[model samples]
Target: MKWSEICIHTTEEAIEPVTNILYEAGAGGVVIEDSQDLQQTFLSDEGSEYSLDPADYPIDGVNVKAYLPVNSFLGETVEEIKQSVNSLLLYDIDLGDGRLTFSEHNEEEWATAWKKYYKPVSVGEHFYIVPTWENFDPEDPNRKVIELDPGMAFGTGTHPTTVLCIEALETHMSKKAEVLDVGTGTGVLAIAAAKLGARKVHAVDLDQVAVQSAKINVKLNKVQDVVTVSRNNLSDNVKGQYAIVVANLLAELVIRLAEGGVADLLQKDGLLIASGIIRPKKEQVKEALIKSGLHVIEEMDSGDWIALVAEKAE
Candidate 1:
């Protein structure tokens, strides 16, 4: 089998939003690239580092690939796939007839390709990220370990959202506090909260795939007894309040939850840690928090992403 690489070149401002659109349209996955990355990886040898200009990087969009069946698709059929991706992309590429080619990998090989990116990382003093397949020897045995694997999930502790949440946990999480992790992709944040001494942790994701992935991750890390996994929408079967609620979702979803979901799930004076906010939408989320009666305690940034630590009004 084989695959085609569809490269979309758009103004630097439209990447993530465009990527989401493509994903909704049936993209198997996406690879985000800017001219700099493209130049380094394909055209030059500099390889991902150069004079930094924020605007030079694509901010508001993404490129996506629609995988076609390599077995049955002829070159002409492949061209149709290109057209499909290209139509959604709204960018120009010079693939002579706009036909790109790819070689398909067996499932094992494809999975292994992503496995190479997983490694152990320490997100905080007491919290460590260890991929399920990797061996992690913590420098201090007393430190807490959070096992994770990206397998079909979005986080393995490398993304800005994951890092920001770790920073939030380091700064404000309290011993014996109950934690609620909304959109707990791979359960990374919940595991971190558990390691930080949260007495109980409840994690939920709308994707059934994510729910299974998170459950496997929690068990892989030996935190199954402390971390509960559920396949429900954020507000679905969840009742009762928690001392700390962590939500790493799109800026819009974060704002909505800040006003409604978090407002109901958080105990008075409880803490809310939210990320997945782009720089442009930071103020929107801040305003939402205030509207929901949460007072901002602190805010931090990782690249263009922002995390806000807020407290429910006492």
Candidate 2:
């Protein structure tokens, strides 16, 4: 069978939402190529053996590629995908170069083309995001590992926004705390919460594919007993309150959640770790959090991304 490979050159902040758009548009799976990945240093000697091919990656921005079967209506489908991806601007998501390109390829090529870009990545001080196909043993026995196969969903746990969230989880997550992970793509943060000793984690995402991916990863990491994957928009259907609420989402989405009473979802003195904000929107997000009755406790910055930790006021 022949397949059409649709590739979008966009920013790291746009990866998760764009991948979801492609999945919803009937793409079988997605591949992400980030220019930043080329700069990551190996944590173990084993990592040195795997060499990355420069020809496969973009020199600037990020590329999200998805495969769709070639058919009579391929043109219409491609047009629809373009329109949907363009719609992300409504949410203030940075598309970077925002170039959409495509090519025709065989099914065999589509199956294996994305594997080389994925590798085991160490995030934060205690966690390693290992691809399912990779054999990874943590150099430190005390370090926790999350085995993941993101499939068509986002959240490899290596993105700066995700890394900041995991770092905050490691620092602020209390033993036995009940946690809520809004927009839990790949369930990375939720699994990290479970590994960090959170007694219970409610991992919620509006995307069904992401919910399934998170479920698989949570099970793979042996955290299903502690993390429950569910389909919910923001905090809409969630009940009760949580000791910690973490959301790695677009800046506009974060603002909307804040304006929509995200604080009500938290217990008194509870922490909210908000990530996925570019430096340009950091203060805007912080203001929204403050308006929602959250007091800023800490801020984490990596590259141009920022993650804010806020607490419910007494």
Candidate 3:
């Protein structure tokens, strides 16, 4: 069988959302080729022949490639993906090269080739993100394992956005508290909150697929008793004030939530950890938070991404 390899040349800031678009479009598998990977040191087995070739990377941005079966609906599917990607510009998201190209391959050529690129990584001080198929026994007692079968949904805490959020949680969570994880893709942050001794965690996502995926991962982490996964739009009609509210969403969504009274959902002196923001867009998000009655107390940066921690202001 033939497969269509759809490639999107986009900014690093757009990777998470773009990947979600592809997965939502029924991608068989996704491969992210970032130019910065050439500079970062990675873990590998002593006898492994794995090495990144310069030729396979884009010199400036990122290449998000997804494999799909060649079929009658291929043309429409590609069009829809293009439209969805183009719509990001409406919210001030940079499209970078904004170029897309397609190539054909045999089913066997890419069916499992991308799996080799995914390996266990330590995302934060306390959490180790392990792919479900891999075996991991942490040597550090403080290091807890989160086994993920990420399938189509993202946020296994490997991405810088999720990593920043997890790190922020680790630093701010000094005592048990009730947590609200907005845009809880794969339930990574909610699971992190649970691991950090959150008395209760409400993990909500707008996407049903993400909700289901989060539910599975939450159970896989055995935090089911502490975390509840549900389907809900971003901060809409979310009841009860939380001790901590973490929103890992786009800058526009963050602003919208902030304006929509996300601060009102926080208890007095509660923290709002906002992430999934590009460095360029941090100011606008911070302004939105402050305007919504929250004071930005801390900011974390990783590559071109930024995460902001804010507290309820008087």
Candidate 4:
């Protein structure tokens, strides 16, 4: 069967919402090519098999790709997808270099084209990301293995913001701590929390695509019992205070959550890890968090992005 290969060249920040848009329009799987990967080193051993081909990535931005079977509704589906993704600007999302394109491909090529860009790699200190298709083991037996079908999820553990969040979770999150993972893309953070010993995890995202992807990932990692995935905007309407809350969102949204009293969702002296803030906006996010009652404990950076680890007052 022939398929329409839809590709969107957009910013990294828009990945989740855009991928969600495609999923809502009947896309089965999505492939993300982050330009940042060109400069990233996934594992310490440079000789490892993991390498990204420049041809697969956009020159200046991220590319989100998906395949849909050609059908009578193909034109209408494409239009709908375009309109829905364009609508994200209403939410103040930066869709930088947002260019859309389509091409035709056979089922065989569509099935295997994305495999070259994905491979098992370690994230942070404890978590190792392995695609379900690869049969591989980490050199460290103690490294927590997270098996994910990346073709069906949001993140591949290559983003710096995500790594910074994972590292912070490893350092500050306590055993059996109930975790609230705000903006849980691909449910990686939620699963990380579970691996690090969080007893109960609530993974929330505003995008239905992420919610569904995260749910699948949570189960794939066998942390279904510990992490509950839901669709919600930040902390609005979320019940139950948590000992640890992690929000890996843009600076503005993080500030909005801070102003919205996201810290109130935390128990006394509990930690809040806020990331996805570019370096220039670091102070802006920090100020907002402090205004909303979180004390800045420490800050970590992964390239231009930053993660703020704060605590609610006891």
Q: Best lDDT goes to which candidate?
A: 2
Residue 40 lDDT in candidate 1: 25
lDDT (Cα, tens digit) per residue for candidate 4, span 1-314: 99898999998778877987898888856788888888765442332554566887888878999888899999999999989988999976788878999998988887887876777778878878877777775777789888777546567765788889999999998889999999887888889899999999999998776788888888889999899999999999998899999998888889999888887799999899998887878898888988898899999986678899999975
Per-candidate clashes, comma-separated = 12, 0, 0, 0
lDDT of 1: 0.66
The lDDT per prediction is 0.66, 0.87, 0.86, 0.84
Best by TM-score: 2
Query: Ten residues in a row with the worst lDDT in model 3?
Result: 40-49
lDDT (Cα, tens digit) per residue for candidate 2, span 1-314: 99999999999888877887888888877888888777675444364434466678899889999999999988999889889888989877888978999898999997987776778877888977888988776776777888889776786778888999999988998899999999998999999999999999999999888899899998899988999999998988679899999999988889988998989989989999999998999999999999999999999998888999999987
State the lDDT of candidate 1 residue by residue for 28-56, as single tens digits.
Answer: 54454333332221101221223334443
Residue ranges of candidate 4 with Cα displaced over 4 Å: 42-49, 206-209
* Cα-based TM-score, every candidate: 0.74, 0.94, 0.92, 0.86
State model 2's lDDT. 0.87
Predicted candidate 3 versus true structure: per-residue lDDT over 253-281, tens digit per residue: 89998999999999989999999889888
User: Regarding lDDT, does 1 or 3 come out ahead?
Assistant: 3
Give the higher-TM-score candidate: 1 or 4.
4
Q: lDDT, candidate 1, residue 286? A: 93
